[model samples]
Target chain A: MSNNISLWLRYKAKLVVTNVSWGLLTFSSRYRAGMLLLFLGLTLALFQSGNPRFLSYRMVSTILAQCAEVGLMSLGMSIAWMLNGIDLSVNDLANLSALIVAMFLRSIFRPTNETVLLICSLAIALTIGLAGGALNGLLIGYLNIPPILTTLGTMSLFRGISMGLTEGKTISRLPSALAVFGRTTVLAIPTPFVILLLSCLFMYYLFSFTTYGFKTKMTGLNPKAAFFAGVHTKRAVFTGYIFSGLLASLAGIIIIGRTLSVAYEYGTQTYIIFALLVLNLAGIKPGSYDVLALLVAVVLLQTLATGFYSKFLTLQGGPFFNLFLWGLVLVVVLALSRAMERWVSTRS
Target chain B: MKLTRLLRHEVVLCLFCVFVVLSIGSINPAFFSLATIFEVIRGAIPYMLMGLGVMPVMLTGEIDISFVAIAASASLATHNVLIRHLRYQGGLAGYLLIGLPMGAFLGAIVGAVSVFSGLPLFPVSLGFWLMLYGFNLFFISPEMRFDLPPGLTGFYRRFLVTVKDPVVGETGLHLAIVYVLVVGALLAIILRYSTFGRGLYISGGNKDVAIRSGYKLGKLLIVAMTLNGGLAAFAGILQCAFKRFFDPILFRGAELFVIAACVVGGVAIGGGRGSVPGVLAGVFFVQLITRGLVYLGIKPVWHQFVLGSILLGFIVFITTRQKLWVIFGRRKR
Candidate 1:
């Protein structure tokens, strides 16, 4: 019995050591930005107001809640940016999908069969997302329009279609079933946060363990070399956009559920900025740790926003101040990351 | 042969512009009136100015989307100063003196940052765009509308030339038309006949070769971006003067429209292959479509959709047409 106990103890010790080493390796690769963000977050939480409101459970949960949809969109955006492409239309795609789902839920069905309605709405939203992504992929990959311009055109196109369809009005009173995924909590965690965690895991797998992910990275690193190596460069580009679109649509579903309504201009104000910020802040070589980096960035932004709002509740132009702060953060983060890269390169 | 030599891409664009105008006029006779033409020209001024600004940057193989934000910021600052001077007797001169240089300075900043950072122009400009926009919003209330001083307003409303129309009321030509003509002509000469223009083309065509040839590429980029900023600011001033009211969102998406105009006019986004005349024609084409849509009684929401479609179609056509022609020529051979 004692021999068996010793053996078990050794096994446990080996497992713990391997796990800790794996985490250390992951954190070290992204240590510069990750450490900076953690320091900032902790500093703000501890000292921003001297009241320590940021350290509260309520504040933590609020930041997580606010970050859910934006985090999901950033995950999608990172995939595209990993391939050295961008999707400026993700926010609009999310908005359009949510609007489609909202319109159907409000006009076509009663709330009698919640399960069936939920399934149908989700299917419709996903289809819209897939179709939008397919269009972007074809235009960019097959037709060879620059990603920026193609996405720009589609941004306007999607926004215009949503405006026309909804006549610039908000669609509300969505079925409770739809809201469950966004609004309800499971074991004290927000449903949207749970969804985000699950999606991040799926994305981590898709980007790390899959052949498609390998092809995407190869294509982004050097399209000419990737092509010569028998990777279908165009197809890789196509799949990148599709992945972005599908994820954006998933974000849309979460948004509609959380807000309990859908508007044409939903997510217009901040998702693009957030996505760009997270993608740039995390510095685009995707790995398992990227998921953690994105979450940290999103929470950091949300903390700053919430902190400012609470501290300056009566200030005029408060919202604009938040926007200015976000822009400043983006610029500073970009500069710092670049400087760090140069410093590390020189030292090495 | 000489006539054909003159008929390059600009001529093709001009012909397309004429065709659009004539077709629209035929559909609605009201569109042919002098008032309609002047109206179109007035609206086209801002776009033309922005295109001219974007052209040089494109020639340097860079882009500056922050011009719209710079324009907005300049306009807001000028408007605030003009309002303060309302108690004192000052004309448009005070606004111009303050606004023009301020615009140019802001443009120079954008250029300097782009040159210094060595980052891609698009992302940097996007950062500036957001920052400037937020700055403007913080300083000026977006919803508040400020009227120009009465002295400047009266002078602004006066027509440089007027024709009395018994049926359609008085159709007066604004001074903006003359401004457009002078600016367009000056830009055309500079682009076609100036050493700076040659440098821009060479740098854009082949950066390494341009470096070998002893051109100061960084300075050239700075100058091009500064000029773009100044022109955008001037356009913003024109927009405020024409509208006689200041709103923070006056030129919200004007950058995209102006860039679209440049692209439609055959200005390659990659640079080194565009002319002032081509850009001007593009400005006219976009303005004509926008105005024509109004005359056709289409809903305003459809305006952006149609514009985006037209831009996409034009780019696709321009890109593929050369390849198609080459293929047919090879078959003939």
Candidate 2:
């Protein structure tokens, strides 16, 4: 296994370096003001402290846990975007699923077993989440509506449902097992991180090793050609949204499960963040490895946020600072990719 | 048939209004009273102002989600002027006139950042969003809340037209409403007749081609943001006048609503291809849906769910090209 992993790493590393070097050689003409700014940001962050090492793992873990719901939503968001579509309804859908789980669990079961109830609750959450996603997929794949507008409409519609379900009250009688699942650490790592890793692996396999994955990419790259090649482009698009919906639901489940309660305000604000992060960091590929890469990007961003907080900077409203940095990062990454694409095409 | 199809989109909105009128007519019969109807239209003034301001950007297939935040921050700034600075003048018109553009200029700065950053719409807008919120809090006391002067409130109330007859007459109108209508009309005319508007369309339709054709894409982007920013500022001050206060949370999460309105009006996502009339129709449609659900005695939560579901359905419908088989009804199988 070690040998295979090392070989795989070497091959990937060579592939990346070759492409990057070729890009540098070709698009070397255009000035890179944005990249310079990003580098400056990094250097500033790294050195602007009595001791910057204080921005360590513990701080990062806490920040990741704080922003995990949106981070998880970005995993699904990237897939929808990979198909050149976006699902703006992700936050509301996630919220709706959480509301459903909260209302159902509270109404049906008495607050009892920590373990058995936890598993059951998770099952319910997953099922409801999948249903919401499927609903979005069916609408998009079959109806021929634009994803942006449809998702925009659905964002409000789904939030309405979630809000309706709870009658505008916070529900908190979640089982202890679910709480442990959310907050507990295994081998000194948060469970959400573990879940994120497993999710990345699953996405990697789906996008890299499967025929469906290839078709999804083809549909994104050129729908006309993909359709001519006998690929059901609409179905691919449909499946993409559904999968996004499912991921959103899962994120909702994780978030609510972690908090052991669900609030109406929980998921509304994070929609844009999840969408922006995935688009900026993951490029436009819908593969498992890309998903994992996005997860790492989120982790890196969390690390940066930690560095900001620990350095005795006015971390009061650190989120605002983090977002400003995030915006800059997005601009730099997009410009870099655009330049790289131009360089590669010119070389070829 | 052609006209109907041309008006197919408006059909839903019409139905919603009819439902509202009929339901209120049945329940409180007086709900349609000129006074009450005026209240409804008056209530709608702020949203209409925002919709008008944002329509041009949407028409060119761009969006300004940060506009609401801009409006909020601008309004907060205007509040400081009206309350703290203008107390010396005792002159209302100067304060109102100056506050309007002052708010817009702040919004324009946000627009400048958006155009230059070359990022996806969400991040840059969100950055400004947080800044605006923080600025509002930091500039004003976080715990301190204030009210608009009664003089300004009296002006809106006295001059603004209210609905005429509850069941069969025209709805209320205000000076603010007139401003909104004028803005919308101006946008429609500009988009239909002007070179700048056409340039915006071309830029949105194909950025690369526009650049190749010698259009300064960066400058155009800045212009679009400027328009969006200025409009946002105007919308913010209007809200302050309408609501009689600069509540920090007055328009929380309002960007989504504005975007939804634009999208429902058939604005394309990647810049270009929408109309001013379509956007107006879209805004009214959204408001109608929200109001109708309440009139029908449905719980407000269901309205939110329905809004999301319908949005998803419409987004999928607009973004995906229909399959040949689906269009030809199974291809003669």
Candidate 3:
């Protein structure tokens, strides 16, 4: 018993040391600014509750779910960013896909648990996602429109169609089986979390290992260099939009499945904020897919939200403070990252 | 020759005018009646306000997405203050004085932040937009119902234009129509003749050179935001009075439309190349399309969709100079 206890203590010491070193590395990174925010957040959470336990497991889980859609959306956004363009219509496309999926299920499936119904729903959802992407791709790729303007137009067009179809109403009454998939977990892990994990892994390999990913990032870093290097810039941009559209569709499915409803206003106005935050938090760069980094950001934001909720009960415009702080945080982080890069290079 | 040049250049505005007349004429036939004409002009006051406010900034090649939020906050502040103090029914003039400044202050705060932050206007203004929106949501009942004093509510009716015909008798025209004209004329003069306006063009046309040449670009930016804020407030006050209620979602997507008008007015998105006249024409074009849709009784969703598509088309058309996308024949394979 004495020997076993000593062994356990030694093992625990190693674990503690490992964690300390990892934390230090995080502090030294450009992402250290985000870490600083997380530290501040955790400190506030503790201060407000007089205990670190206030940031409960359920709260973390809820935040992970909140970040999941944005995380998925960001993967596509990061690709677009890597390809030197942005798709402003990401959230709209997600909402449109959700609305389309809900409509399809309601009209055809008739609330079934049958294998066939589930398969059909999945296929329909994926196709609608692709179609939404394809529309953006067509305008941007074939028509040779600037991505900024093309996406802006599609953003409005998709949102209008979504609202028009629903007449600005929510589509609830999702099939119970699908709702189960949305909510169910293996060992307390939600389906969306699992999907998020798999998607991240897929994107990691797509961006890190593939020739296409290499070309995409190269194009983004220096379009002239990439063009001279013989990368098909138009096709790459088109692919990026399609991927973005697909991710949005997946987000829509997850949102509807989780919420069991879809509405015209469901995903409106969230694209820019979520995308901007996620891209910045993930330490966006050419061909870099850091799941750990994004996860950290998700946890940090969620904790901040909780801290804000608990600390300020006053209506003297406290809620607005969070948005202001978040926006400021984004700017500060970007500026700091730029400075840090310069500092690190000088040291090297 | 001058008349011909004017006609040629103002073609878009003329086309819009024709579109408005035809649509209104068909819808109620009475739509072209004296009262209806005045009503249409009165209704267009807000868009004109936005167009005029944004013209100088767009000419500088920057965009402000914070107009609606600033406007909404100003309108709400005025309403809240008026409700507390202006309880005794005040005349139209009384409401205007209180409401206008309330909006201007809110706008100036946004302007100050943008000028000081040294951040891109799009993201920084977006921050202001969200912050103000949150405050507006919580300040009023989240559902956003404001109750004006009987006198103030009645005073707002004076904004309507009154017209008297030999056969039709008298109909009212909104005082807002005059506000639009005055504001437009003021902006036109500044754009055409003022050094301050020239500073805006130079700053937007080339920021590095503007700074190198010793122009106080930062101060000029503040002035732009201040004017934009003031006009936006005026538009908000007018709109809130016209609608007679305050909703959190009021003007939710209005900033985009305002920017669209600026773009359609042939103001380069990159700064330093558009005229006030062009912006006014753009406003007329947007107003005509919206009014026409309304006259056609198009559903609200379809209207939004069409507006979105049209806005997209304009941006695409404006941004895609043929030089940017030349396809080398050999590269296609």
Give me the candidate number with maximum DockQ.
Answer: 1
Give the range of the ten consecutive residues with the poorest summed lDDT in model 2 chain B.
B320-329
Q: Which stretches of candidate 1 lie over 4 Å from their true place?
A: A1-33, A40-44, A47-49, A109-111, A285-289, B1-8, B85-88, B140-147, B164-169
Docking class of 1: acceptable
Model 3 — TM-score against the truth?
0.82
Report the interface RMSD that candidate 3 achieves against the true structure, in angstroms.
3.5
The models' CA-based lDDT, in order, is: 0.79, 0.66, 0.70
lDDT of 1 by residue, B188-303 (tens): 88877888888899888999988898899989988888788778878888888777777676687777788889988988867788988788889989998999998878888778
Model 2, chain B only, scores a TM-score of 0.82
lDDT tens digits, residue span B1-333, model 2: 353355454565566567767775687565545555455556666666676667666645565677787777766776776678666334346545765676567656665665654554555666567656656655553533446565665645654554456344554555666766788888878877987777778888887877787877666666666677667777766666665667664586777777777767766766677776667667766676666556557786566676666555555555553353255545543
- Model 2 scores a TM of 0.80
TM-score preference between candidates 1 and 2, better one: 1
Model 3, residue A44: distance off in Å is 9.4
| Pairs clashing within candidate 1 | none
| Model 2 Cα lDDT, one tens digit per residue, A150-268 | 56666767777667777788888765567665787777878777777777788889888899989998888888899999999989988887788777877887787688888876846
Individual DockQ of the candidates? Answer: 0.40, 0.38, 0.27
lDDT of 3 by residue, B1-333 (tens): 343355443475567567767866777564566665555566667877977887776666666777888788777777666676656465445556776666667666665665665545665566677767776766554666567667657545674545676534555777767778888888878867888888898998888888887888777877887888888878887787788776665688887777777777777767888876677778767776776676677887787788888887776665553343343323443
